[model samples]
Target: MTKLTSLTIAEARAKLRAKEFSALELTDAYISSIEKSRTLNAYVVETPELARARARASDAKLAKGEGGALEGIPLGIKDLFATKGVHTQACSHILDKFQPTYESTVTANLFDAGAVMLGKLNMDEFAMGSSNETSYYGPVANPWRRKNSNATLVPGGSSGGSAAAVAAHICAGATATDTGGSIRQPAALTGTVGIKPTYGRCSRWGIVAFASSLDQAGPIARDVRDAAIMLKAMASVDPKDTTSVDRPVPDYEAVLGKSIKGLRVGIPKEYRPEGLSSEIDALWNRGAQWLKEQGAEIVEISLPHTKYALPAYYIVAPAEASSNLARYDGVRYGLRVPGDDLIDTYERTRAAGFGREVQRRVLIGTYVLSAGYYDAYYVKAQKVRTLIKRDFDEAWNKVDVVLTPATPSAAFAPGEITDPVEMYLNDVFTVTVNMAGLPGIAVPAGFSEQGLPLGLQLIGKPFDEETLFQTAFAIEQAAGKFTAPQWW
Candidate 1:
């Protein structure tokens, strides 16, 4: 018999509907896999009982042929999402043991589709780090390691645990968010598929905010087809979230295997920065050639404002984070440290609750939003953001979609990057999509010399994720699937 935990969501869904195995059996396989893979620290909490109950309920629905699209699929929810009566702390000390009374719109959508919860996954505290080291729960080790080396690598972040869990086969898929490069970067590092849909494509009402304007929920999955399937079930408009778009969610999976003949694929010159890894550059070239062979018209384009995207993203995201996080004062539901007085209590509580990375970002956000610096930093960054968007708007006139290397290099060992600025550069290739409020997907395309996975990113026009899914399928088909050696 095939290892139940090794099946992709698409395979599992079909087999589940065919009654080859009950949902309870599938859920048990994952629960057992997760228990044995704890060395990766992918899951901060495991809800086996909850998952079993949901799975049994799904089996009942399936027996009557009345279940939803995700009918029996088990998924990991990023800690940043609110799961009612479950741990939803965003992996931060500040939000210690906090469980929301309400469910995030994305997770609710998944559950409504009959997906089972596998518990909250770890992440960078407040979704504030390029690597997962900033999480109060500690870093998630990437399932992929270097060739012939046992040193553990980071799975990228702030969606590290989501990516790790999927790559490790502990979940069929995972709900992840992208503020800058949270979802894509981690997916790239871990040899999984992730998409950061266009801003406002999904509701954010129950998600713990990092940078409200930049954060968007999507899915991390074993492959592009699985990602499309999960995203369809995850996206929906909600009255509770004013930012949620009123547009209809399309069937993304339907577009897979579609031909891309004459489709204009843009290659941005600015993306080929100096000192790019040779292996990554070679794979990127091969990706274009693969698309071109399939009749995609490769066009060289320029997004001049992309050079400023990283700095602008840092400024804009942190500024929003500081304002959004202000509500976490000691008086609220989270952790509180009593002090001499109310003000002292607020100060002490924050000082104690926030992790170092969160504190640094909050301070940076506060400083940039301060009266004297707001105009210089925040306003200027906003202007740069507009230019970045304009750059994409211009590119759309000449191309159907844009392609770039997902990361500068492959996954690195934790603690290899110490300088904050150096760490920020990990997102240089991905932050522009968030700045432009566009949809982007990362597909595993190749491997590094060290034998770690590498990925390519596809950026699409707003609300044109169908094109992204179709094109990513092309890449996936050509490059073939990558699987980490099962060391856990």
Candidate 2:
């Protein structure tokens, strides 16, 4: 008998519809896994009672043959989303006990589609940092370890917990946000499928604001089909979010095995940056070969602004973060430390509440947005951002999709890189897509010398997630799923 937790969402859904197992059984299996895997610290808050209740409701719906698309699929919600009345803190102490009365548009859509909530997964505090180390809830240990080494590794940021949970099989999929590669990088590290849909594909309304312009919601799942299904439920135009495009959502799963016979795949010259690992480079070339074997035409294209994307992303994201996070000054909600005066209270509360990484970004953001340095840093970065987009726009004319390594290297043990600059380099390959507001999917392609998982990213045109699903499925068919040898 296979463990229920090992089944992907697609498999679980089929079994549930065939009456092979109850949603209650599925939910209980996940809850038991969550309880046992607490040492990983993937979940900041456990909502067992809520999950059970939702699972029962789903069972009832299935009994009536009226189950929604996600009918009974259990999922972890990244702490960044507001899950009405449940713990939703974005894994930051500044948002202490901050549970919303209304649901985030993405999570709300999931719930509407009958997805059960496992709990709030851990993340970088206020979605800052490349590693999960900055979370006020503590860092999430990657489910995968180097072969024969007991040393724990990071699952990648800020969606580290989301990626870890999926890899650990605590949930079938997870709701994750990408503000400069949070979703894709973590997925790459954990060997899960993650998609950062076009910027407006998922609504920003009700999500804890973090570089709002760059932030978008997507799913981290065990496989590409599950990711496609989850995204179909998670993405929709919402009246509450004006940024959400008013386009009709397509059935992404339906496009999975579609032929890419004449598909043009762009191999970016700039993506082979200075320090890319040979293992990752070989894996990227292998992925390209696999796609080409399936009839994709590989073309060498250049996005020259790719080198400037990371620095500009740092400037733009933190600047917006500083502005967005300004509301957490202890006056309204969350942690508040009193001071001798109102100004002092604001200063004390912020300084005390925010983690070190969060504080660093806020200061950088404030400095960049400050009057004297605005044009030189923030405004100039915005101009660079435009060039980044134009670079992608130009590439689209020659290629249908862009193929690149998801991360420069495989998962590294936590605290391996102490320097902030070194850590920021993790996003070197992923940030460009975010800057361009393009749809990107990370699919596990191979492993490293240490036997940790590595992935290749597929970047598609804006609002063209269906094409990404199609291409990613072809890669998945070739590389197959890589699961951790369960150590927990």
Candidate 3:
């Protein structure tokens, strides 16, 4: 029998339905694996009992012929999603003791589909860092490393834990959010398939806000098919979230293994900038070549305004974050610090609660949105953002899907980037898709010389995840699933 850790969601569901393995047994296997792989630091909180209870319920449902596609499969929830009766801190001190009274729409939807919840996973504080180091719980270690080397590698953030847990077989798949590369970057680092569906594809109502305009919920799994299953279950239109699209959700799994012949894949010249690594450049070329072998028409195109994407994203995301985080005033929902006066209470609480990076972003955000500087910073950045979206609009006119490197380079060591601006630049290749509210995905293409994973991103037309997944599935089949790190 294949261990629970190695089986895909579809395989597990079939076996489970046939009474080959109980949901409790599967959950136990993953819990045991998590215990054995302590060094990965993937989870911030483990809810084994809760998971077992949910699994038992699923098993009962299965007995009654009431099971869904994901029924009884263990799934990891990124700490960013609000879970009712569970602590959701966003891996930050500011909301340390915060427990939500209501479940996030995403989490509720997963449960509604019969997926068992394993636990809340770790992440960079407030989804701000490139590496997982900025997390209050400490950095998550990459499972891959050279023999006899004590060097700690990065599990990319802020969805690092989600990717790490799935890669380590702690869960069959995980729910992840990408506000400027959180899901895709970590998926690349941990060598898993992750997708950021079109902006409104998944409801964001219960997810903890980071960059509201850019944040999107998706899935990270071992294969494209598993990702599709989990994504379909999680996607629903919620009236609570104004941004959630009310359009009909597609059957993502139904179209898997479909042919990609005659599809137009655009290769943006501007993505291969001067400073990108030769190894990455080579892998990108190899990926494009592989698509050609599969009969995809690769055409070179220009997204000329791409150069301004990073700067504009920084301005827009932080501005939104500052406004979102202002609700944590130590009064209503989160931590509370007693003070001498009303103003003192707010100042002292925020200063003492938030991490340095979070504080830095808050300050920058406040400054940009301030009365005197709004026109010069915020307004100008929005215009640039519009131009960046226009660039994509022009490209999509001629192509069905756009292909590019997910990150400038593979995962770096923990704490490699001390400068905040440099850290922000890590999302250069990713943030634009979020800005345009388009769908994107990161699938493992190959590995670097040091054996770290490299990923290729596919940006699709608005709400056109079918094309994105088809393109990604083709690439994933060509690349082959990566072997798990031995240390895991």
Clashes per prediction? 0, 0, 1
TM-score of each: 0.99, 0.99, 0.98
Per-residue error for 425 in candidate 3, Å, reads: 1.8
The per-residue C-alpha lDDT of model 3 at residue 314 equals: 81
As for lDDT, the candidate ahead, 2 or 3, is 2
lDDT of 2 by residue, 1-488 (tens): 99999999999999999999999999999999999999989999999999999999999999998899999999999998998899888888888888788989899899999999999999999888777999998889999999889999999998999999999998889999998889999999999999999999999998899998899999999999999999999999989999999999999989989999999999999999776778988999999999999999999999999999999998999899999999998988999999999999999999989988888889999999998999999889999999999999999999999999999888887789889878999999999998989999999999999999998999999999999999999999999888998888
lDDT of each: 0.94, 0.93, 0.88
Top-lDDT candidate index: 1
Error of 1 at 359 (Å): 0.8
User: In candidate 1, what are the lDDT values of residues 1-488, reduced to their tens digit?
Assistant: 99999999999999999999999999999999999999999999999999999999999999998899999999999999999999999998888879899988999999999999998999999999988999999999999999999999999999999999999999999999999999999999999999999999999999999898899999999999999999999999899999999999999999999999999999999999888878989999999999999999999999998889999988999889999999989786889999999999999999999988788888999999998999999999999999999999999999999999999989998999999999999999999999999999999999888898999999999999999999999999999998888998
lDDT of 3 by residue, 1-488 (tens): 66777898989988999999899999999888887877888899999999999999999999888877789999999999999999799998879688898998988988998999999998999888878888889889877664456687888888989988888888999999998998888888878989999888899998889888789999999888889889889999999998899888888887777888888999999998988999989989988988888888999999999989888888888898999999988888666778999889999889988889999989989999999999999899999989988999999888999999998887788767888888887888888888888899999999888778889999999999988888888898899997665655
Instruction: Compare candidates 1 and 2 on lDDT and give the better one.
Output: 1
> Which residue pairs clash within candidate 1?
none
